[model samples]
Target: MLSLRTRGKSGIYYIRGSVSLNRQTIDVKEFSTGTSDKDAASHVMAQYQMQLHNELLFGPTAKVADVTFSPEM
Candidate 1:
């Protein structure tokens, strides 16, 4: 599950979490939302979570296949 935390005296909010896939635990820690507002941070956290979920559900994302490469002499 995802969590929010503050570093020391800093009021900035960050996201930390872990997801288990294929018997391996991937820890996503200290992801900065760049804001002190909890609402904003929650929005950012949701985006990150969706990204992670897509990667896990569909495997690694590949974009190079969409690009055309030209041969160099």
Candidate 2:
């Protein structure tokens, strides 16, 4: 998976992901924010949302995230 911002004043954003299956590749592309500098939180949230949506829409069954955080990390 890769995410990047567009050049110049476009302020456009792009996201790319690829999965290989059955000796073939399936690619997914999406855009969220325009070419702008995104804070870390926004970028993370964007990726999280995309993954969740893709799972619900394309997978056999959607699984919710069970996230855990620790100070020791």
Candidate 3:
């Protein structure tokens, strides 16, 4: 499931979620939707979630994400 949260006081929204495949869980990191507006952010986040779903189901044929956030090592 995907969820949105405000980033500090910036008014910007970010997405976070997790998906499971073959009993393996993938934790999607928080990703910026690049918009402060909740409605716009939700739209963008839905697209992203769909992309992820397609890729997982269709074996990488889906479009790749432009931005990926991984914790700095």
By lDDT, who's the top model here?
A: 3
Which portions of model 2 show Cα errors greater than 4 Å? 19-26, 40-58, 63-73
Q: Is candidate 1 or candidate 2 better by lDDT?
A: 1
The superposed Cα distance between candidate 1 and the true structure at residue 63, in angstroms, equals 7.5
Model 2 lDDT, residue 45, Cα: 41
Q: Candidate 3: where are CA atoms >4 Å away?
A: 21-24, 64-73
Best to worst by lDDT, what's the order? 3, 1, 2
Residue-by-residue lDDT tens digits, candidate 3, 1-73: 8899988787889999886667556578999898899999999988878777766776644555444789999
**Candidate 1 — which residues are off by over 4 angstroms?**
8-10, 21-24, 62-73
**Which window of 10 residues has the lowest lDDT sum in candidate 3?**
58-67
What TM-score quantifies how close candidate 1 is to the native fold?
Answer: 0.70
Q: Write the per-residue lDDT of candidate 1 for residues 1-73, one digit (tens) a residue.
A: 7888876576889899876667656589678899988899899988777666656655655233334788998
* Pairs of residues at least 3 apart in sequence or in different chains that clash in candidate 1: none
Positional deviation of residue 58's Cα in model 3 after best superposition, in angstroms: 0.6
Angstrom error of the Cα, residue 65, model 1: value is 11
Clashing pairs in 2: 11-34, 11-35, 12-34, 12-35
- How do the predictions measure up, each by TM-score? 0.70, 0.39, 0.73
- Output the number of the TM-score-best candidate: 3
**lDDT of candidate 2 at residue 22, scale 0 to 100:** 49
